[model samples]
Target: MNAATQYAISWKGLKNGTYHFDFKVDKALFQEFESTEIEDGDLNVSVTAERTEKELSLHVAIRGTVTVACDRCLEPYQQPVAFDGDLLIRFSDEEQEYDGEVLWLAPGETEASLAQYIYESIVLALPYQRVHPDGGCDPDMLSRFRIVSEEEFEAIEQEAEARHAQPLDNESLSRLTALRQRLEEEDGESEEKN
Candidate 1:
């Protein structure tokens, strides 16, 4: 089946009532679309379409796991996804943009493809930062990246604390004061020369 036909719903022939549909979305679907972010997943999508006198209401529910490369360690891991959203399809004499949740369908349009909406719903549900939880990432890969051990971190922190704790000695203070005086004298000589 064509990409559009694969997810098309023929609502024109159906009477005004409620209908249900179940779709198994897998790697082939993503490959057909040449999707880069998500190439492998086993998800079940349940759609409920309610046809009314002038409009159609669709409720989409998606559940399952998708494999993605971790942003931190670059290792593949399965991430669970579960979300539901609603959409409204309104028939129009002429094409026009409808705001939020509502879709405008031109006159004589008989079928609507759920592919785009279904794809977006799943992608938007994914986290912006894809990563493993805590220490779930591969330790060997993580080590290749810039990360310090507990002992090294502790040593650095202690060095900072010690530097802050120490006060300047009297001899060092005197040296600084004399240096400041010499710098001022040099400034005076330069002013005179100018």
Candidate 2:
């Protein structure tokens, strides 16, 4: 078969037994997959394939470091990932079905490639929200965030104060005070009513 097929397992040669394989995935391998999340990094993958008369089972363990952009500052940084999972490759007459951690393949199929499994393990290992620790971020980036936060806080406080200091004539003030008294009386009444 072609390179991609070769990287994937061929079901024809598989025997009804367990097999162990180790692979080192580098930048070139990621390029082959066109994976943007992991542009450059060396990943260690240990896979175990067990075949029975009825179906096949695969277990994959992956550990590596990948360079990814920081969500906060948009700067590139290294992130370590570790993953361990199992896959059940059952024979099906219909099309493949992949649910969460399980896979269904054609019963007639012989070999299954580990490439897709490795890629998925790496993807799953990534954090949902990636950010550097509080003080671990870049100085300039942290300062910028701090300044923006302070400015926003000041603006909000000013808006609240301005709202509180609205100009009111004596008549309006008296009406407002009367309204306030009415509200207080209503609250007191409710408290007693309750």
Tens digits of per-residue lDDT for model 2 on 75-166?
Answer: 67777889999887777898955775666677666666666677767878888656565545676875675323334445544654576767
- C-alpha lDDT values of all predictions: 0.77, 0.68
Please give the distance, in angstroms, between residue 168's alpha carbon in candidate 1 and its true position after superposition: 18
In candidate 2, position 138 carries an lDDT of 77
Model 2 local distance difference test score: 0.68
* Tens-digit lDDT track of model 1 for 1-194: 76577777778988999999888888777777787988598899999999998888999999998888887688988888897999888889987875547777876889887777777777888886777876788989877864443444456445545666686566655755565565566456546644
Clashing residue pairs in candidate 1 are none
User: What number of clashing residue pairs does each candidate have, in the order they appear?
Assistant: 0, 6
For residue 60, give model 2's deviation from the true position in Å: 0.8
Model 1, backbone clash pairs (residues 3+ apart or across chains), number: 0
* Candidate 2: residue pairs that collide: 8-113, 9-112, 9-113, 10-111, 11-110, 11-111
Instruction: Give candidate 2 regions above 4 Å deviation.
Output: 1-3, 144-194
lDDT of 2 at 128: 69
